[model samples]
Target: MISRVTQQTVQKSTLANLQLNLSRMSDLQGRLSGGKLITKPSDDPGGTASALQLRASQRAAEQVARNVDNGIGWLGTVDSALQTSLDSLRRARDLTVQGANGSMSAQARDAIAVEIEGIRSAMLSEANTSFLGRSVFAGTSNTGVAFAPDYTHQGAPGSSVERRISSDATVRVDVDGSAVYGQGPWDPVTATGSVFGLLDQIAADLRAGLPISDHIAHLDTRRDSMLGELGAVGSRYGRLETVQQGVQKTIMDLKGQVSAIEDIDLAETMVELQSQEVAYQAALGATARVLQPSLLDFLR
Candidate 1:
């Protein structure tokens, strides 16, 4: 059977082909202008899904980087406070040693006591140090000060503040003030005693002209504790730094991946756009010729 070709079929086919060519040209131009290979899901469903996933990963990595930066700042504040506390303790220890000397007169001991009192005040201030208006050594306590003026601990105990630096990694950013300063004045009676209590005892003994040998030993022990904390803070700070570096690298890598998935190559896009323009022009010419012949046949 011989099939008759109609003018209607030729006109419809020409219009459809021209529309497709125009659509392709529009898409290429959009890609070139937007600098994105996939502006819509219909453009490339698989590639759109991949780009969305990569964008989500990039956003998450950026958030992690921010968390790492905040953690670093918190740890830095802690490290600085601990260093100051250590210095105060060392100075107190030096005074205690000097006060232990029998050759020192009562007036001299009194002066040492005054200086020790000042050091105690300074240590208390350090213990109450705040970072971003929150106590750095107070765990999650919402109190403005970690330690009260009466040497009472106002912060919560045994709580940890942590920051997520990556998808699978978290790091602690706070230290326990009670561990460093004892349970404030409520601390149990011990050989070394609470940090504040030890300083008070040392000052009292110096003022009373009493033997400070045990007090000296306690001071040394407290100093050792402070040194240990300083070491721990330093270790945590170093870990944060390392984690920050890794997070930064991950962010960069994620950005690159997102770019690969979503961003267009300018040169390639320009070449494709030119090719589509040429094809669209040829389609327009072909459509005109096809439609003219169909119109003549329809007239006949």
Candidate 2:
């Protein structure tokens, strides 16, 4: 025997179909408004997870780029100070050469010594140069001055300031002042004579009419050390620039990946929305026609 269909079952089926069509339309409208496929994790769990991961990676790359910029600034400050110090040392060397000439009178030698002293003072100031309120050549020391008042190195030795430019890389942004200027107490016997001490001794020799050949050699050595440090600073600056470029590119790529995972296809979504609208209207019309007549009409 065949089972008889009831009007109540027919009405229930129509209501369920209508509800499903309305839900589909609502979801399409939401995607259109938001312009993204993954409005919530439930929309597309795998795609939402990928988007979150990419967003996190993008943020980290941006932070690393900022660190690279700060590193570049610190290295630039150090390079500028070293340049000024190098110039002052060269000037002091020129005066020393002139003072060493036997043809120069005592008064003339005294005048040269005075100028050399000024150069030495200026070099000391450069050594104590600071960037962002911290000594650039003082390693990790937060002291405002890299060198003490007595021409002694005041910055921490063997400690460097480093900035993380990438996941696997850290770059040193500071120089070791003690290595370039020698240690404090400026010992001549211990081979730790600073440029300041060397200039002071040269000034004394000029006044006493003593030979300054050894002093000239020491001056050259200090100048060489300064040059080496300057070169290292330039190298680090160049490396930071390269890292900055790489980070910028990584950020761009990560953003693209996130967009692909999270952003909606407007054209395709619009087409699907129009199709759903047509189907929903068709279902409503069919339900209206099918439910128009009832059991009362059949009894009449």
RMSD of each: 3.0, 2.9
**Residue pairs in candidate 2 whose N, alpha carbon or C atoms collide under 3 angstroms:** none
> Candidate 1, after superposition: displacement of residue 207 in Å?
2.4
The alpha-carbon lDDT assigned to residue 90 of candidate 1 equals 83
Q: What TM-score, over all chains together, does every model reach?
A: 0.87, 0.85
The best candidate by TM-score is 1
Predicted candidate 1 versus true structure: per-residue lDDT over 49-116, tens digit per residue? 88788788878878887887888898888888888888888889888989999889999999999999
> Any idea what lDDT model 1 has?
0.82
Candidate-wise lDDT, in order: 0.82, 0.87
The window of 10 residues in a row where model 2 has the poorest summed lDDT is 183-192
Positional deviation of residue 263's Cα in model 2 after best superposition, in angstroms? 1.0
Q: State the displacement of the C-alpha of residue 201, model 1, in Å, after optimal TM-score superposition.
A: 2.4
